[model samples]
Each structure stands twice: as structure tokens, then as C-alpha cells.
Target: MIDEATARERVVSTADRLFYAHGVQAVGMDTVRAESGVSLKRIYALFPSKDDLVLAVLRHRTNQWNTGIAGAVADAVTPRDKVLAIFDFLAAWFREDSFRGCAFINVFGELGGGSNRVAEAVRAQKASFQCRVAELVRAAGGPGYLAPQLVLLAEGAQTTAAISQDPDTAAHARAAAETLIRCALGDSENAPTV
Candidate 1:
């Protein structure tokens, strides 16, 4: 028999896979229950409602992505390298055959601009990501312009990868990002101040 922790984990894992692969609107509670091998009652007992479950799944995904990106950026010797790490991270993720797209972006599209807890979570996560990138750019001596431009380029690369089914899109974006970083830093050889 699965323990309570195991059962909750199973439900979360199943929901993450299903929700990320299919839009949040497309996957029903029954599908999650069936896939998780947990009864509907058990799922409701754990999540309370579909909205709660959606929040849990989104939170889980957000945490996972945060950890992964942080790990990738942590070892960088300079802030410039840290900024480039974002593209490297995306390129590695795009190599996976099962890569669907950015989960938050997909969920936002599925929600269609309605104000809800899930929508708010998506917005918060995206804002946090942009802020993080901006911080790295600022540390690399970039003015205010670098952050928003880098954010736009990253978003564009993500959309292009999703639409074109081209994993190399990230590589191309990384090249462009390098040029931007050089412009921001003013000198390729100068180590960032902080």
C-alpha cells in the first residue's frame, strides 16, 4: 500500500506530466486519478479541488524549474557567463524529445486572460524569472536596457522552439545573446565588477 506521502507525490507527478504535455484545460480530474492509480476521493482529499490541484502542479513545476536554472547558473565564473547560462539551459532542455514548451506560457494561453489563482501564479513565476535575468544583466554592467531585451529574446527563442520544432533555435538565440552581452559589457575581456 502506498503511504500518504507516496500517494501525494504520485498525484503530483502524474499531474505535472499530463498538465505539461496537454494544456491544463484539456486534462480532467478523472484522467489524473486514473493515471495516478489513486481514487477520485483520495485526490480530492489531497487537493480539495481542481483549482487547488492546478496550483499545486504549477507550484511544483515552478520550483523544479527554479532549482534547475539556479544550479546551471551557480557555477559560472562571471555574471556574463551567468546570463549566458540561461540560453545554455534552454538549449539543453530543448534537446529532450519530449520537450513540449514552457509550462507557464502554455497555462497562460489555456487560461485565456481570466483572473484566477493559477493565472496569478503563472504571472508571478514569469515575473520572477525576468527579474532574475535582469539582476544578472545588471551585475554584468548592463544598463536598464539589457534586462528587458534579454527577456524578450528569451521569450522569442522559447516561442520559436515551440513553433518551429527546431531545437537549434536556442543555439541561435544564444549567439544573439552573446552579442547583446558584449554590447552591454562594453569589453569582452573586462571582468564584471560584480
Candidate 2:
């Protein structure tokens, strides 16, 4: 017999994969059950409802997003490099075979109008990400005002890359971010770009 935690993990991970590739509304519980190999009874017992499962998926994805960004930043040697590393992460993520844009944005576009919980979760995740960017901006000696602009660039890049199927969108966004960072932080013109 599978333990509750193991069953829950299977369901969430499977749901995340399906929902991201298809969409939140397109895939149903039965599909989740069949794909995950977790019985419907176990899925409902663990998630209680589709909304519950979706929320769990969002939580799982959020953990992944945070870990990726943190690792990217951690590998950088300087504050400027740390800030730029976010786009490096995005560029790499955009090139993944399974790339389907930000799950939070995808779900919000599909269900944000009808589901308050889903909307709130997406908003909270985005806010957390923006806050992280803001902190990085401060550390990089950029003016506080530059964070939102940088966040918007990153957000826009995700959407553009997903829709255009162009991994270079992140590089374009990275170039814009470098310019913004230089302008806000007063970096010399001779500073290397890239």
C-alpha cells in the first residue's frame, strides 16, 4: 500500500506535468488518476477536489521556481551577476523541451476570473517573485524603483518566449535588464554587456 505522502506526491507531480502541458481546465481528475496511477479514491482523499489538486500543483511549481532562481543567484559571484542570473535561468528554462511558460500565468489566464483561490495563488506567487527581484535590485545598488520594470521585463519575456517559441526572448530581456541596471546604478558605459 502506498503511503499518503507518497500518493500525494505522485498526484501533484503528475498533475503539474499534465496541467502545464495541456492546461488547468483541459485536464480532468480521471486523466490525473490514469496518468498518475493513483486511484481516484486516493486522489480525492488526498486532494478533496480538483481545486485542491491544482493548488497543490501551484505550490509544487512555486517551490521549483524558487529553487531554480535561488540556485542561479547562488552561483553568481557578484550582485550584478546575481541579478542577471535570473534571465540566464529563464533562457535555460525557455529552451526546455517541456517549456510551456509560467504555470502561474497560464492558470491565472484560464481561471483567475472564476476562481478566487487560483487568482490569489497566482498573484501571491508573482508578488513573491517580484519581491525577490526587488531585493536583488537593492543588493546590486539599483534604485528601488527599477525592480518593477525589471520584473515586467522578465514576465514579458516568459510570455513572449512561450508564444513565439523563441528562447532568445530571455536574451533580449537580459539585454534590456542590463541597460536598466546600468542606468539605475550608474555603471560606466565601458562595462561589459553579457
Candidate 3:
């Protein structure tokens, strides 16, 4: 028998992949068990209900989002570049074959009406991301209002890329973000070369 941590990881990861590829409402616990190679009993032990599993997958997706954004920002030379790095990361992610748009948005759209927990989880994830952007904007000397505007650009890029199947959507968003950043900071020279 696998330990609880390993079993939980397998279930969450498998469910996350399946739910992202398909819709959350379409995938079931049995599929999670088959994909994860974990017994149904074990899955139930770890996550007593489908809602529990869905929440776990959402948390895992949040971690992935944070880690990817952090890695991209870490390579930037300036705080302003760090803000731009977010779009760079999105561009790369949009180009990936497995790209299915923002998981939080998808899940929230799918289950947000019926599942308050899912809605709250997605809301919290988005709020946390916006807060992170706000911090970056503050560090870059951007105005208080710039954070949500930048986030909207990023959010719109994800949806557009997913629907349009165009990886360059991120580049377009980046250009707009740069313009906004320049306007907010009142310095075109501060914008990155990207």
C-alpha cells in the first residue's frame, strides 16, 4: 500500500490533468483511480468526496501557476522586467501542446455556480495572483490601479490564446502591458526590450 502523501499526490495530479483536458464535470473519481493507479478505497480515504478532490486539484494548479511565474520573474534584471516576465511566461505556456487555458477560470466556469467551494477556491487563487501583481507593481513604482489592469490583460490573453489557438496572443498582451506600464510610471525608458 502506498503512503497517504504519495497516494494523495497521485490522485490530485491525475485529477488535475484529466479535469484540465476535459471539463471537471465530465471526469469522475473512477477515471482518477484508473489514471492514478490508486485504489478507489485509497482515493476515498484521502478525499472523502469529489469536491474534496477538485479542491486539491485547484490547489495543485495554484502551486504550478505561482512556481512558473516566480521562475520567470526571477530571471528579470529589474522589478519592471519582473512584471513583464509574467507575459513571457504566459507566451511560453500558451505555446505548449498541453495548454488548456487557465485552470482556475475553466473550473470556476464549469462548477462555480453549483459548487461554492470550487468558486471560493478559484476566487482565492485569482485574488492571490492579483495581490502578487499588486506587489510587483508597487515594487516597480507603478500606480495602485495598474495591478488589476495588468491582471486583466494577462487573463484576457489566456482566454484568447486558448480559443484562438494563437500563441502570439501573449506577445500582444505584453505590448499592451508595456504601454500601460509606461503610462503609469511615466517613463518609456523603463520598459524592457521584450
lDDT of each: 0.85, 0.93, 0.93
Clashing pairs in 3: none
lDDT of 3 by residue, 32-125 (tens): 9999999999999899999999999999999999999999999988999999999999999999999999999999899999999999999999
Error of 2 at 167 (Å): 0.3
Q: Summarize candidate 2's per-residue lDDT along 1-194 as a digit string, tens digits.
A: 89999999999999999999999899999999999999999999999989888999999999999999999999988888899999999999999999999999999999899989999999999999999999998887788899999999999999999999999999999999988888888766544376
Per-prediction TM-score, please?
0.92, 0.97, 0.97
Model 1, 56-132: lDDT tens digits are 88889889889978988996778888998888888988888878888888877887376488789998998998999
Off by over 4 Å in 3: none
Cα lDDT for residue 173, candidate 2: 97
Backbone clash total, candidate 1 = 0
Ranking by lDDT: 3, 2, 1
